[model samples]
Each structure stands twice: as structure tokens, then as C-alpha cells.
Target: MILLQVQNVERLFGSDVLFERVNLDVQENSRIALVGRNGVGKSTLIKMIVGLQSPDNGQITKNKNMTIGYLAQDNGLNSSNSIYAEMLTVFNDLKKMEIKMHELENEIATFDHLTQSQTKYDTLLSSYDQLTHNFKEANGYGYESEIRAVLHGFRFYEEDFSTIIGTLSGGQKTRLALAKLLLEKNDLLILDEPTNHLDIETLSWLEGYLQSYSGALLIISHDRYFLDKISKEVYELTSSGTDHYQGNYSFYIQEKAKRFQQKMKQYEKQQEEIEKLEDFVARNIVRASTTKRAQSRRKQLEKINRLERPTDGQQEPHFQFTAERQSGNIVLSVANAFIGHDDKPISGPINIDLRKHQMMAIVGSNGIGKSTLLKSILNKIPLISGEYSFGTNVDTGYYDQELKNLHANKTVLNELWDDHPTTPEKDIRSILGSFLFSGDDVKKVVHNLSGGEKARLLLTKLAFNHDNFLIFDEPTNHLDIDSKEVLEEALLNYNGTVLFISHDRYFINKVATSVLEISKNGSQLYLGDYDYYVDKKEEQLLLAQEENKQTGEIVSKQPEKNSYQLTKEQQRQERKLRREVEDIENQLEQLNAKEEEIQNQMTLPEVYSNLQKSTELQESLKKTQDKISDLEDSWEEKSMELEKFD
Candidate 1:
């Protein structure tokens, strides 16, 4: 079942073609990623598929029964309802069924007392039973649980559920909108930049949730790690046309390289043959004996389908970081620092010993002061407590996530040239060109540049600084995937140390030699990349759980008890807990099986038509479900206790 098909799609702006000959098919349960450089019209293509816009040259086909959920980059929930109420709107149909079932139950009860009309009584009972069955089949009984689970995944808590939609921030509203869309469970989910406001923890949760999703997903995101996890195939839109890759983002990279090499080889071979034929024709056309043969060869040349020269897709910015001088072994040191603003500490008592050539990534949940800590070190904000220092002769360059250092009124050329007054205008233009600003682009004011352009301009300044140490806050924020790769490569090759804060797990994994996990209380250092930090964090959590378990055991025991007796008692307790866990698990499984069997039996024609038999089965299913619920509770308690011993 193809949920959506885009055939020979083309979009044009005036006389200029944006893209042409685009074709893609989204089958049932497809996981796809749409990737391209900035300004490549990926969002425009999504609009065409969702019927928000029409293609200029071709058609988009969708199944008549198919429903689409589209979340644009800037869209948010618009409602006067509370947060939880807004989410509940997605289940209005189920709610209506529930209300009708209640009404039916009351009416059936009233009719049960009237023995004067037996046929009407039987009819009421049958309708009530049918409605009950439909309610259960529609998951009317458990829709609230589903809502709660999704709300929690999006970082919305029970206490915040009652907050009015109008009171929420724009980002929070956007997140809620996404939560509502996920609850809708449409046939196809088309998301443009779904990873926009998510931190790494939430991103991980979203990845896990989408992995088991039952419908098709079409995502446009610059988060490469996310694309690798959520996408099964990739469609890369380019100015010339669209290219399809049959794998995840990682595979797409490798496969794209292989294809590019093959194309280049074919093009080179064809060019060599063309050159030889043209030379032969030019030399022999004037000679009478070979003129006929030359004419025949010329016709053959005209028939040839000339291959276009292979290119590296769109022109991406080139980045290179070269240090003018090397600093001492110790590049930066922070001692027991408290970082925040307005004489208050939001996070810290932080410590860092950044050494030369070590790219350390600072990571934490959003709003944990990761960026503030960097600002504190850079003297942009006052440190509430403690101190930091740079090593001997170490110069630092900073890349602010907000681009606060850029002057709004300055032209792109002046922004760089002002910093290097001695540099010639031509030389400054050359540097700006490498960063993808050329001619009229150089004259654009800093205030008018897009986020990507501003980011590129900032990088241009940083690259020119030639400092021994660099500190960045969310350097990958506005960069496309291609530009991020370029920045990563530049940093990896630079002979300097870096300490940066990033929510991009992929960027951190690529560039960081160490990871600093920060919290409101303090910070801890892991001597490896992002992946290593996660593994070590998990290990630490397990150790803490085990230690807490041991402490509980010690506190429960009497001091007078002998060691051997305590050990024997502990072992016996563990065995008893394990047995209880296993027993509860088995009982729950049996009860679930019985409940399913009853539901299945009720669906049969012979049983549903017979009121008494259907009623009996429903009663049995209710009992089985109640028993399953109790056993599930017991299973969870016993399992937790058993885990403590392990």
C-alpha cells in the first residue's frame, strides 16, 4: 500500500527552476528522511505531498482513505483549552463512545426493571452489549494512559497538564502540537525539522518511540544522528533534481560517495572518447579520401548522449582552522566556579582542566547552565563564585550561539575586514567567498542575514583569529548537516584545544575527545566521546542503585545478628522475592490470555447473537482483566525488589 506517491514533481520560482524530475514513493510504514542544503525547497516538496501546495509540473497521489499529519517548523497549537484538554481533543470520538456507553447502561438498567415489554428489554440489552464491545475495541478504557505516556515523553509533567495553552511559551506550544499529532496516528506523518526544540534526552526518547511507530514517517531534519536512527531511506533534494539512497544516513554517506566516484569515472571515459572522435573529424574532414568516413563519425557523435560533469551537489562553505601559535600543555583551567547571572548561581561549583588539542564537549539537559558557564568563563557574565584562567600565551576565540558579537549594521565584508584592518579589500572578499558570501552577498547587512548566513560569517571571523583555544556554545545550531560536517572536519584538524556546549550528539561524538556532564550542583568529566559518556553514566546509575539496595539491607538488619545468619537470611529473602515475582508474572500472563479468549469468543456470531452467552463472556472478561491488573501491580513491585538483590 503506497500511502503517497510524488511523480515527476517540479517547482519553479518565476522563470527559474527550483528543482525538476523529482519522484518518490512512500509506502506503508516507510521511514524516510528528506535532506538537502539550506534554500533547496525541501519544505516546498513536503507541502506538495500534503496538498498544501501544488507541484508546477507533475502530480502527488495519495490514497483516498489516507490521513496526513504535518508539522511545519514554526507551527504551534492554537487553542484556549488547557494542555491536557488540548491533547484530549484527539480522542473526542472515543470520548463520545464512552458517553454513549454510559447512557446505554443507564437506559438498559431502567428497561431491565420493566417486565411488561420483554422484546424491548432484550433489544436494549443487545444494544448496550454491542456498545460496550465497541468501546473496549476502540481502546476507550486506556486512552488516558496513552495521553499521559506521550505527555511525559515530551517533558510535560502531571502538574503542568492543567496549564492553559495561552500561558505556554512558543516552544512549549510547538512541542504540544507535536504531541497532539503523534496521538492522531495518521497514515503518514510529515515532519519538517522535528528535532528543532528537542534536547538530546528528548531526542533519544522520540527516536525510540518512532522506531515502533505503525505508520509511515517522512522527516526533514539536519540532525544526522536522528536521521540515522529514524530513517530507513533518504531522499536528497538538489537544485538539479532529487537523488534517492536506499539506506540510513550512514549508509547514504558511504553509498553516495561510491556513486559519485562511479559517475565521475563514466563521465571521464565518455569525455576522452568524445575528444578522440572530434580530433579525428577535425583532421580528416578536408581530406577527400576520408571525408565520407568523417561524415559517418560526425553523425555518430551527434547521436551520443553527453554526460553532464559530476559535481559535489550544492556549493557548501569551506572551513579550515589554522592556529597561528601553539599554547602550553594546559590551555584553560576552571577551579570550583559558580556560573550564572545577576549575582545568582544557576549551576556550578564546576571544575575543568582543559589541555591543549583536547576538544571537550559540555553536555546536560536544556537550561542547566551549559551556555551560561561558557559565558562566565569568557567574562560576558559575572561568576558568582570561584575562578578560571588561561594557560601561558593562550589566546581564545568564542563562537556565540546567539551571534551577539556581530554588529547589526555592519556589512558582511565590514564584519570581517573591520577585525583585520591591515588586510586588503580583495583579500577580505576572498575569505568571505570561501564562507559562501560573494559579490552582493558581501554587502548584505548582518541584521538581514539568515541564521545560516550569520553562522557562516561568525565562523569566518573565528577562522581568521588563529587562536590557540576556542570556546563555542551550540556551534551547530544553525548549520545544515553539510556545514556541520565541514566545521567538524576543521576542528578535528586544528592544532588547538576547544571547549564547546552542544545538544548535537552526533557533532559531539565527531569532535570531542572528552565529555563534561554538568548539572546544577556540579560537573563530572568522562575521558571519552559522547557515546562513552552515556555508557559510563549508565554504569554509574546501576552502581548507585546497587549501593542503595545494600544500604537498605544493612539498615533493616539488627547489629546483634551474626554475619553468617545475616547472609543466610538475606539469601532466603532473595529467593522468596524471586519466587513471588515469577508467580505474579505467570499469573498475569494467564489472566491476559483468558481475557483475550473471552473477547474473541464474544466476537463470534453464535455468541454475540445470544444475549445471555455474550453477557456471561463479558462478565468473565471483566474478572480476568481485573485479576490481570492486580497481578501486573504485584509483578512490578516484586520485580523491583528482585532487581535490588541483583
Candidate 2:
């Protein structure tokens, strides 16, 4: 069944047309991810869908009895209420029903004899029982427990629940709002960057919860991994309008490229035909022998509709960062480093070496001293007892999240002008335009700019500067998916030594050649990328589990054959085959796991009997079968390679 339909929707902000002739149909239990650059009207479209804002033209229709829960970018939660009290608001109607049921039960129990009053009491009792049944069916009995579990998953402790929301930090409040949205049972859930304030654990928990949730979900997020894990369809909001692709983010990218290539080919073919027709008409129109034929061709040409070629000018930007000079092997070093503020020790006795052409990520929770460590490295803060050194010829560029260096009183154009006094005005304007500060927007005061705009400006400066070594703190904080992609591509292509702090897993995975994790215990180094870290962490967890099972001795798994130890040609072939097999196996495991989970859920009498939930699960089961078929074909090829090796 169609959950919601948006038909020919046109939205206008003042005289500017945000979107026009937009049509979309959201199906029940569909998982759609909205992606675009900032200020592309993604939020406005969502607002229109939820009836919070009206479109200038067109209509939005929803199925009767459908419910929606929207979590906005700016969490609109009152600061005076406690977290627990705020979440409890979702159950207000159910609580009222429960109270009425209890009152009726008490009255029914007070009747002594089988009189007319007792019959009326019995009738009341029956009505109360039905209401109570619905309350329980809605999971009202464990509602508070569910809320607590969600809160805990989002990094809220029992002790933090009673604290006034006004006292909590901005990130903490956003998390609280996310917790409320997740706990509320609704037919459709719209979440915008819900993972922005979430940690690794909380993100994992949310992934699991959403995988199991029965509602339709529309999420807008820059976290590629999150979108890959949850989204089945990708809705790309572009300058023209929204384009729909029937797959996750990765699949969408591949399919979109293929489509663009096909469109280009067709456009070229059509242009060639049109050119041939026009040349024939021009050369032969006045000839006595060919006048009739030329007139016929002219008529056909008049009726022909030209095809418009696909364009991605807004999506594509050429990003190149020039380096001033090469850095020494030892880019930066810290020995016995002890740093803190107010005499409190954040981290100390730290030893690390950052080398040339190396990219490192410093990862930890909020307020855990990741930023503090960066400041100490830059000598912005005093190191109590440590010897730090930078290798010769290292020109450092620092990108702080606070944007403290930006002049608030200056306009965007003036800000760039002040920094690059020698740069031509037109060149400065072009640079600003690349960062999406175009037209009259360049005249906006720096202080009035949004967080995303400020971040873009800072990054633009960092890119334009000639620095061999870069240090960034929370660089991906307010960037949209497109801007994040641009930054990721630029960094991946950069030759400079880079060390940055980021909470974005996708960015870290793409750029970090090494990872430095800081914990309460101490800091540890990982020699590879984010995926390698995850694999090592999983191995450690399994090892710990085995150790717990056996009292004293460690039970370690035996190592598999090392393909690297083989001959050069054999090793290359082995690596290729292994990667292919791993990809297939991963797909197979995901599909099998989803099938089993769905089957188990459907086996429950209540779930199987529900019209909406049952149908949605059944459709998902069919999609799983299709996925398995594709995986089987890939696995067969890998199996053939294994046979040849044997």
C-alpha cells in the first residue's frame, strides 16, 4: 500500500523556486535516504510532507490512519524538562487509557450480586478489557523500559536522566531528541542526520533497531556506512528535482554513472541525426528535383523533440591542493607527553611518531581530549612535561572546528580578501562560488553564516593554502554529503602528511592510513585503516570471550595459510580470488541473516496476523531471495578459482 504520495509538488521561498513539478510516492515499509548539498531544500520538502509547511503548488496525500514521527535537524525539545519526562510524553494517550481501564476494573470488582447493576458492570468490564488489550498490544506495558533502553543506547545513563535538559550540552540534547523519536511508534519515521551526535556504539545500536523496525524510514545523513547498512533506495535532491535510484548509496553511485554514460550516448546520436536532417534541408530545399523531399524533411524536423543532455555541473567540482614543500620523515613527534587543563590530566606519557605522506585519525568520544591533544601538538596549550618536535620544512595548516580565526564583522568576500590581499577580486569570488557562497551570499556577514557554511569556508581556506602538513579537528562536523565527498576526494588525492580528528566513520575509512584511538585507559596505535581496526577489534573481542570461557589459559584460533608467503604470481592470484570470495560471502551472510530474522518475526501469531507488518515482511523476503541469487553467481566464480588453485 502507498503510505504517502507527493504529486507535482512545487515549493517557493520568496521568488526563488526551491522545487517544481516534483512527484514522489512513498511505499509502506520502504527505507529511503535523501541526499544532496546543503541549502537544496531537503528539509523544506520533508516539512511539507509532514504538514508543517505548505507547498506553493501541488498536493500531498497520505493513507488514512497513518502516523508519522519527524526528527528535525534542530531538535525542538524544551530545555526545562528532564529526559525521562520528555520521552514519557509519547505515552500520554496510552497512560490515559490505562487509567480508565483500571477505574472500570475497580468498579466491576465492587459489584456483589447478579443484578442489572452487575450486568452493566460486566459490560463495562468487557469494554475495559478491550482497551487494556490494545494498550498491551501497543507495547505500553514495557513502554518506560523501552524508553530507558533507547536512552541508554544513545549514551544516556540513569544518572543523566534527571539532569535538567537546559544544563546538557547541544550534542546531548540532540541525542535525547533522537531517543524520543526512536521510541515513538509510528508508521513513518523521518530522521535528518540522526547519527551526527551519536558514538560508534550508539550508531551500531541504531542500525540494529532500524533493521528490525516495521515502519517506513526516510533519513538524511552524510554517513555513507550508515546509509549502506540501512537504505534500500536513494533519493538525490538536485537542482532540477529529486532523482530516485533503487538501491543503497554505493549502488546508486554506480548506477547513476552508468545512466549518465548511456544518456550521453543517446544525446550524441540524436544530435548527429538532427544535423544530417538540417544539412539536407538547407542544401536541397530550392532544387527543383528535391523540393518535395526537402519539404517533407522540414515537416519531420519541425515535429522532432530534442533531447537534453545530462549535466552534473553542480555535483562536480575540481579540487586540487598545492603543497609548498615536502616534509621530513619525522613530521611530528611526542615523547612522554603530559597535557591537561585546570591541573586535570587528560592524557600523558604519550609516545607517537607521525611520518611523511601518512594520514592519521584521532578518534574518541566528545570531551575526551582529542581536541586537547591536537592543541598541545600545535603548542596552543602548554604541555606540562613532554618533548615535542616537528621535522624540518614542515609547513603546518590547522583547521579548528571553532572557526575562531574567521573575522565575524567582515563579509564573506572581505574575509577572503583580507587573507589573500594579492589575489584578484574575480579570482576570490570564483573561489567563494566553488564553496557555494555565490551571488549576494558573498556579502553576508561571517557571523551570520550557518555552521555548515563556516565549515565550508574554513576548508576552502585550508585547501587554498600551501601547506605540507595538515592538522584538522572535527573537520566533517557540519558538512553535507556532497561537501564531504569533495573533501574526501581532495584528501585522498593529497600527498601531504595529514593528522586529523573526526567522528565520521566514512571519512576516516576513506582517508586514514592509520588510526590512533584514545580511551580512558590509554592510547593505542593501529597500523592500518578503519576496516583493519574493526577486524582487529573483533578478533580481540572473540579472544576475550574465549579467555572468559576457559579460566586461566588463552584459547586462540589457529591462523590460516598466508597467501603473502606464496610465490609472487601465485600470491597475486590468491589475493584477487580471496577478495572476490569475501565479497560474495559477505553478501550471502547478510541476506541469510535478514531472512532468518524476518522468518522468526513472522512466526509470531500477532505479527503474522497483522495486515501491514505481514505484507511488508513478505515483500522483504522476496527481495532477499533476489539478493541471494546474485550472490550465488558471484560465489560460483570464486569457487572455480579455488578449484583451479587446488
Candidate 3:
């Protein structure tokens, strides 16, 4: 079943067509990734699908009875309720049913010997039974446990459940909103950059959860690893529209490249044929000997339609880092260092050495001071203790994750030109254009630029400076997936020492020659890329788990028993119990409908006017009501015992 479809969707901003004739479908349990470069309308198109924004032309069709849950990038959740209370609100209807179940119980007991007693008792009994069945079907008894499981998966401790949501940080609030959406259990879930601020352990837990998610997922994310793990299909949105691919991100890249190459070859071949036909027509159309052939060829040329080359107009940025001078073999060294602020150390008791041309990536949990370490090494702030030194002839260039080096008041043109005043005006403009800031875009003020644009501007400056040593802090923070690849290529090709902090595992895998895992316990080095670090970490974990198991300190989840493989006697008992429950439920539904009919008849003048007839109906209703009450007690007992076995 198709849950959602976008048919010929079009969007425009001030006459600039972002994407048009876009078509895609999300089938039952589909996992799709929407990807494009910055400012290419992936987000806008998603907004259209969710109805937050409407398309200029065409329609977004969602199936009847469909429910959708959307989580936008950095959308802060606002609520006065505590964390646990806020999550409970997702099941408000279930809570109401729970209250109704109790109310019906009270009403049923009070109607014992009243006039038209049987009719009233039957009505109450029927309401109670139906309400009880609905309550269990809605999972009212298990909601709290589900909530706890999701909270733990997102790294929320039980103690924090009582904290007011308003007191939480922005990232925490975002996470809470995501948890609420997951519990909503909608038919379709759309998440934009859901991996923001999540650490490796939490990310691992989330990956497992999403892999088994029952609903369809349409995600927009820059985390390549996450996309590779979750997406079964990829939608590559471009200037023309979205192009669908039948596999994960890695597969999409290879297949898309192959497609383009094939298209290019076919286009060239067709062009050669057309050229030959045109040459014959032009040269021989008026000649007596070959006029008939020339005329036929001219007609063929008119009938032919030209093939277009498969290239989106958007230009990929070129980032090249060239060293100005050779640095000493020891580019940087920190001796017995403690790195932090004025009061206390955030990390260290450390020692590190970087060679002339080594690219080292810093990895750590949030607030473990990866950025602070970078600042300390640059001598921008005083180190808490010990000392550090840079080797001779090392001209360091810095890329602040915050982009604090750029003057906010300056325009994009002057942001670069002001740094190199002696450079030609057109040269600076050309560099800005290289980063996709062309024409009027360079006239925008620095403060008005998007995070991605600011990052590009910074890179433009860094490239022009030609420094031999580079230090970056979260350099891939705001870059789209394409820009990240470009930056990775630049860093890999640069012949200089680099020490940067990043949580982009894909980027680290592509560029880092070494990894430094930093924590309060100090820093440890892994002499390879991100995968090697993960493998080594997993090895240590497996050994720890083995030791714990031998010491009787390990506990595992108790999986439910498989019913199909049960012993013959057990299967007989299980079958009998299941049939009993189903029989009771069906009987209760029929009795409720009959009881409602009796009450409606008693209220009419036709039956109420005739007291003898009313008395006869009442007696019949009483017997039915009494039987239902007995069944209710039986159901309760059976349900309790079933829970134990289940």
C-alpha cells in the first residue's frame, strides 16, 4: 500500500524554480532518504508534503486514515509539563478510556434492583465490557513501559523524567519531541537531521530501534552512516526534480555515476549521427547526383530530437589547501598538559606529538572539551597547566566551528577582500563565486548568510592564506553532504599537519590518518581511521562483557517463548485459553448491542404505555445482565492468569 505520493509538485521562490514536476511515492514500511546540496529545496519540498508549506502547482496525496509525525531540524519542543507527563499526553485517548472503564464499573454496581432493573443493568454491563476490551486493545496497561524504553534509548535517565521540559537544553528538548513522535506510532514519520547532538552509543541504540520501526520513514540527514543503515531507497533532489534510486546511499552514489556516464556516452553517439546526417544534407542537397539521398537525410534531421547532457547546473565547490612553507618534523607537541579554563581542567594529564604532514581527528562525547583543546593548542587561551609548543615555520590557519573569525558587519565580498586588500577586486569575487556565492549573493552581509555560506566564506579565506598547519573545530558542522565530500577531498590532498575536532564519522573515515579519543581519563591514540577506532573499542567491550558473564555480573533480556514450537499439551492449553478470550469478547459485543436496543424500546411510548409488556422485557433484560456480570468476572480472572504466562 502506498501511504503517500507527491505528484508533479512544483515550488518557486521569486520566479526561481527550485524543483518542478517532482514525483515520488512512499510505500508501506518504506525507508527513503531525501538528499540534495544546500539551497536546492529538499527541506522546502518536505514542508510541502507535510502541509506546512503548499506547492505552487500539483498535489500531495496522503491515503485516507493516514497519520503523519514530523520532526523538523532544531524544532524546540515547548511544554510546561514534566518529561514523563509530556510523553503521557501522546496517549490521551487511552487515558480517557481507562477512566471510562472505572466509571462504567461504578455505574454497573449501582443499578442492582432499580425499576426496569434488567434493562438498566444490561446497559451498564454492556458498556463496561466493551470499554474493558477497548482499553486493553489500546495497550493502556503497557504504555508506561514503552515510554520508559524509548526514554532510555534516547539516553534519558529515570531520574530526569520528573524534570520540567522547559528546563532542558535545546538538544534535549529536540530529543524529547522525537521520543514523543516515535510513541505516536503514526503511519509515516519524517525526520530532518535527527542525528544532531547524539553520541556514538545513543546513535547505536537509535539505529537498532529505527531498523525495526513499523512505519514508513522519510528522512533528511547528512550522517552517511545513518542513511546507509536505514534507507532502502534514495531520492536525489536537484534543479530539475527528484531522481529515484533503488538502494542505500553508497549504492546510490555508484549507480548515479554509472547512469550519468551511460547517458553521456549515448548523447555523444547520437550527436555524431546527427552531425553526419546534417553534413550530408548541407553538402549534397542541391547536387543532381545525390539530391534524393540528401533530401531524405534532411527530412530525417528534422524528425530527430536532440539529447541533453545529464548535468544539473549547480557547480560543486573546489577547495584546495596548499602549504606556504615546510614545517619541522614535529609540527606540534603538548607535554604533560592539562587543558581547560580558569577554574579547573576539562581534560589532560596528556602528551601528544604531530608530524609534518599528519591528519589527526579528535573524537569525544559532548562537553568533553574537544573545542577547548583546539583553542589551548593555538594559545588563544591560557592552558590550565603544563606546556605546549609548535615547531618552526608552522604558519597555522584556524577554522572555528562558530565562524567567529568573520566580521559580521562586512559583506561577503569584503569579508574576503578585506583580509587580502592587495588582491584584485575581481579575484576575491571569483573566489566567492567558486564557493557558489555568485552575482548578487556576494553582496549579502556576513550576518545574513546561512551557516553553510559562512563556512564556505571561511574556507575561501583559509585557502587564500596558504598556511602550512591547519586546526579545525567541527569543520563539517553546517555543510551539506556534498560540501562535506569536497572538504574531505581538500584535507586529504593537503600536504600539512592537521588536528581537528569532528563528530562526522564519514568525514573522519575519509580523511583522518589517525584518531585521538579524548576524555577526562586523558587521550588515547588509534593509529588508523574511524572504523579502526570502532573495531578496537568493540574488542575491549567484548572482553569486558565476557569477564562480567564469567563473574555472574551480566544480565540479559528474557525473550518470550515461541508458541508454535510448544509441546502438544501446552499447545492444547494455549489454544483453549485463546478461544475462551475470543468467545467472551464476541459474546460481550452482541449482548451490548441487544441491551442498547431494549433501553431504546423502553423509552418509547409504545412499550412504556403497556406496563405488562414492559415488565416482561425487563425480566428478560435482567437475566441477560446477570449473565454478563458473571462473564466480566471470568474475563478478569482469565486475563490476569494469561498475563503471567505471556
Best by TM-score: 1
Off by over 4 Å in 1: 113-116, 286-291, 549-646
Error of 2 at 64 (Å): 1.6
Q: Which candidate is the best by lDDT?
A: 1
Writing each residue's lDDT as its tens digit, candidate 2 over 32-111 gives: 99987777788899999999999889999999999999998858466688888888888898889888888887877776
The list of candidate 3 runs beyond 4 A from truth reads 13-15, 101-137, 549-646
TM accuracy, model 3: 0.80
**What does candidate 3's lDDT look like per residue over 240-327, in tens digits?**
8789987778768877897899999999999999999999988998999999999999889888888987686768888699998899
The alpha-carbon lDDT assigned to residue 550 of candidate 2 equals: 82
Per-model tally of clashing residue pairs:
0, 0, 0
TM-score of each: 0.84, 0.81, 0.80
Clash pairs, candidate 2, are: none
Clashing pairs in 1: none
Question: Where does the lowest 10-residue lDDT sum fall in candidate 3?
Answer: 556-565
Could you tell me the lDDT of residue 535 within candidate 3?
69
Q: Please tell me which model should have the higher TM-score, number 2 or number 3.
A: 2
Runs with alpha carbons beyond 4 Å of true place in candidate 2: 13-15, 93-135, 313-317, 420-444, 552-646
